[model samples]
Target: MIDTRWWQRGIFYQVYPRSFQDTDGDGIGDLDGIRRRLDYLAGLGVDAIWVSPIYPSPMADFGYDVADYCGIHPMFGDLEAFDRLVADVHARGLKLVLDFVPNHTSDQHLWFRESRASRDNPKRDWYIWRDPAPDGGPPNNWISNFGGPAWTLDAASGQYYYHAFLKEQPDLNWRNPEVRAAMHDVLRFWMARGVDGFRVDVIWHLMKDADFRDNPPNPGYRPEEGDIGRFLQTHSADQPEVHDIIAELRRVVDEFPDRVLIGEIYLPIDRLVAYYGEDLAGAHLPFNFQLIYASWNAESLAALIEEYEGSLPRGGWPNWVLGNHDRPRIASRVGHDRARAAAVLLLTLRGTPTMYYGDEIGMENVPISPEDVHDPWEKNEPGLGLGRDPERTPMQWDASPNAGFTAGRPWLPVAANFAHCNVAAMLDDPFSILALYRRLIALRRVHPALQTGSYRPVTAHGDVLAYQRELGGESLFVVLNLGGETQRGIALPDGVAEGHVLLSTRLDREEKVTSGFSLRAHEGLVIALSAAT
Candidate 1:
């Protein structure tokens, strides 16, 4: 055991700063806006807040493409504002985690500029630059994640630079010792500033295969059915050299006590566990994205939970994320009716839970008109329409103009009928999904079993999902209906549990209905284990 502390318990609020709050009237969010929302976050009872990248960038990849590792981006406010935000977050008993993008940098960044200045510059080898093929083509056929060639020809240097993502953001050559040292210095700079931790970006893609062989063709590449999931680029990337780099990053974290590193790795659970490092020196939590990939069915999820728990080595801590900026929000995945059940299950699960900014109120993805879309993904794919703008819509504070995001038009349109799903209205209505989330968090806090308990799956037929969490002296049973129809006679196995319905998002109006506890359609119930029985 790693001697768990304050960080091990409770939830984390992930704020996508650009869409979180815009303190300035420039139609963009900034650090000061985050400072203003501290009380709102503290009221939500999360131990810390994870801010997406606010570093200097050209906005090509929207802050993911960094120009300066240590400096704050002018659009997100200056360095002083970040310092103040850190101080304010700490003052309110909250930890602040900044996003670190060590995988790549904006081509406009000085480092890339220096590297491009000459083929023999001291920094030329810091980034991956390759020679053109015999036919004046890209070095390889590997595609950038955003589409097109991953390699871009630099006219000034007469060489091709590699970017796993966008051409504007060149990937760093971690194989170089200088590059690794510089990345560590970036960590040291932030640690010196009192920042609590970093959300390391693209940890799995840190190092590339040395031979640079071509990725095998995807025989199962079916765009209509998401068959790209099976195209393993075996000879292309995710090399073993990545572990050496992770150890170096872990060493930097070790120098600063209590500082944590969370990785954005997309590997399977078995491979993901290796990121925890042999001596617990790698990523503190290589994000478990199983929920995103699992079939939205009860039996499959139950099996996945069992597998997820079984895959962890003793002393390895697990973290669960339901939504992020890149994926569709949780409400959109399973639809609005089942959002509460998802919330109950997410909060009730026994690992760190991360909630997207507007997920608490059951905010669905907005409609992204092709003409108004800004995501490069949508731009590249054209008809695919898989961009993230809809999920990343401005937070709906109220039903007012622009959803109170700004007096000016928001960067993206707010969801239609915002009046019905606004946070302000939800706060006013006692039966709102927002209130249900607040209660769900409170229940998790009040019950030690819910926070750090051992999870056990209960067998049940149909779309009914059931599980139990047990701790030192208490246990709580969770019953959820993931489908539309009502499930009944959920006999609680041997019915040893005798406690009243602890909380329910749907049972509020029908408390006296029957069965002592009957789950309504798309509903959830958390009941304490009755002591006498």
Candidate 2:
């Protein structure tokens, strides 16, 4: 095996900058605030942090709409603050990964402004613009992933610009050579500033169908699946040409030694693996989102893991994410009890795992009233159960007001249970979720089998999901009870007659086991098996 890269063996903590910590009393988290929290993150044992977008933006899509690719947002900080933050992050012996929004730019961006100035402008081709159909309507039946028509009429030019998301964020024409060159330079600008890597956003949407064909109607569509799911998105996303773009992007990143590229893709296991590129040249790790949307059950999750493992390209690394800025917190989805077990499951799996900012403390989604909702999707399509505000609440650092995330009022309200679930409350409690996460992270670091070993699923009836990770004569067995009630006498895999329980999600004392092992409801544990001579 190629020597394992730091990113491959390390745990990734994703910090949504807006909600991580606020230092300027502006009700928003900034670079300075993040710099102040480096000690806390290091204490948590995470190897690196993948920060969400902090670049200059109009906040149209909450910083996804980049108005300036090479500059920090005023709300976050200036170049000096960002440079200091990077230096501090490296000083802590942790890597920093910035969110790179490559598919589009804010309508207010200089390039977009020039593109929209006139039909004959030199940068007119920088964005996707087309003349209206004969009926004076949109060019096709394509709809934005956010809601409504994908094409927004530009009255000044008598044309319509297409957006995969909000109209304020127009999709860039990656087909244009100039646009590709400009975006590549954005990478170089940050690389020179000492960034460790980037998590490219919406990478699959970089190349839409050249003919602008209408997406097909979804046969599995349901009223509750949101407007974006009303169609299959076959033509508008996952076009084959997108691979070439990814290959070129990878080439640019390779110029910087020890730097990596991560792509955020929500495609199927087979298609998602393609982003790794032929010869493993695309994304170093295409964010695996199977656990994010999979059914919360043992059978389903086991099948999903097997499918993903079977689909990986030769020499391709794997990664897992349970929660992120765009999704509901894992504690909210699977209940606080099961989230502990999920944490063990996530970290023990044979791959790199990413933890959302507040998940280590068992943070759940806070309810957001209609007036408090800030997500563009919820505003555009009301009552679709699509608002992300609940999951984007400020980090609950302590019991203080606003969860100690800000000196002033936070951009989003802290969870009501913050007092009990805050980091301070869990810091010393051995049974707390935060403690469980730290233990799991530490175990992963010390155990080579848990880091780069091969995964072999063991047959376990009922709600028990069991697997073994073996490497260099070291074998670790992980078993999880995903059910709501106690499960007894779970048969250990044959030939694993005796072992020592190294750690348990409950943070209880280790025990020696033989043949059969019983598990409490929502319990998970790792047992170290004796190596065969």
Candidate 3:
């Protein structure tokens, strides 16, 4: 029998702190706001809440740029507020995971300030710094994820510093022993504070090529893909040495019981699986984001899922992410109807599923006007539609002004459809997407087949994707229609003559299936299969 940890058998909900709620009337979500919503989160049926960063910073990249790794940002809350939120979350039997950003820090950080203060500063090696090229240009051709060169020349120091993102956020030198020790202490500090786990940001970028070689240009790069894609990033990220660093970090997390370390990696399936490390010693859950980028069709998704599952290392667990703060919402990527079907696919997959806040209500991306844009990526590289502000808009809780996310003006504009697409509005409607999510989650919790069962692909035709999850004699069948046209006469897997509908995306179906069933356009169904004779 396989030992299933809480994170492995449970659903994770990502809460974007700046947008989840606002309690101080500051137009920004704070720790207190999250505390006030603990009951709502517990009722949502998620086993864990993975909140985005709330560390002190200058908002260079929102909360991703950390100035103080051990403290909470005043904008979000103080130590008291964070401690209270953690306690409240635990009291409700829910785990809380914080975003751990060890790769970079805000330029305003004391460490960075001390490093750049002078060449003789003890902390000069804390961040990645190098002498400028002979031409007084950047050290190399590496490009920042935001845009342009990754290196920024500091006049006072007469040396270039590397930043994988904006200039305001400088990448840390993980190669330095002191840097590693300090970062490990940061993890210890949080773990001591009762943090259940950490979702490490940009985990793959922790180690860079020691040679500082220039990355080769991509011949297939397209103008529409933005400047960051101009190169293949061969040297800037995903170094083999990263696995060792991850293993070290894993040791720190292991010191605490039942703690998890989820790495945010966006590599190909082959490279992504390597983060699990030999003998499964790396991150507990290197987040699988292929679902977010894969083509949203049955054939494409089927192939992608099969490849991902096959690529996992022995004893390595898998997880799925449909949307995140950095990506477009599901409803916007796929239409609202298809988003419902996608939700079923996400929860029913043979791995842990992470639900982004507001996705339960089918929140679509809101348009961000030029004046309203706050994302540094959009400001640095405009017209590529790479801005994340659209997806990070304030959550919609009700029909009240500003969608009840705040009494004051929201930090970002609320979605235009918030009045109709909100938690409160959907709570009253049994057929709402919110209701469907609740039922699906409830079903997943009660069924062992949906938790740690073996996955087998069922023979599916055309736009229908079919699969089975079975643990012992208990079995569940999942079928989804990924197309816009209704499918009829779909074949069922062998040994499964009929099943009772447990839940449907439409939230209007509950009957026994004895023959080929018809699925509505953009629909999904979870069925409890009868015992095989």
Best by lDDT: 3
The candidates, ranked best first by TM-score, are 3, 2, 1
- Residue-level lDDT of model 2, residues 1-533, one tens digit each, is 33799999898999999999999899999999999999999999999999999999999999999999999999999999999998999998999999999999999999999999999999999999988999999998888988889999999889999999999999999999999999999999999999999999999999999998888899999977678888988999899999999999999998999998999999999899999998998999999999999887888999999999999988888899999999999999999989998999899888899999999999899999888999999999888889899999999999888889998988888899888889999997888989998898889878888989999999545789999998877889999999989888876667666889999889995988877668899999899986433
The candidate, 1 or 3, that scores higher on TM-score is 3
**Ranking of all predicted structures according to lDDT, beginning with the best and ending with the worst:** 3, 2, 1
- The TM-score measured for candidate 2 stands at 0.98
Off by more than 4 A, model 2: 531-533
With candidate 2 superimposed using the best TM-score fit, by how many Å does residue 245's alpha carbon deviate from the native?
0.3
- Model 3 has an lDDT value of 0.92
Model 2 clashing residue pairs (backbone): none
Per-residue lDDT value at 406 in model 3: 96
The C-alpha stretches of model 3 lying farther than 4 A from their native spots are none
Residue 199 error, candidate 3, Å? 0.4
Query: How high is each candidate's TM-score?
Result: 0.95, 0.98, 0.99
TM-score attained by model 1: 0.95
Residue 173's lDDT within candidate 1 is 93
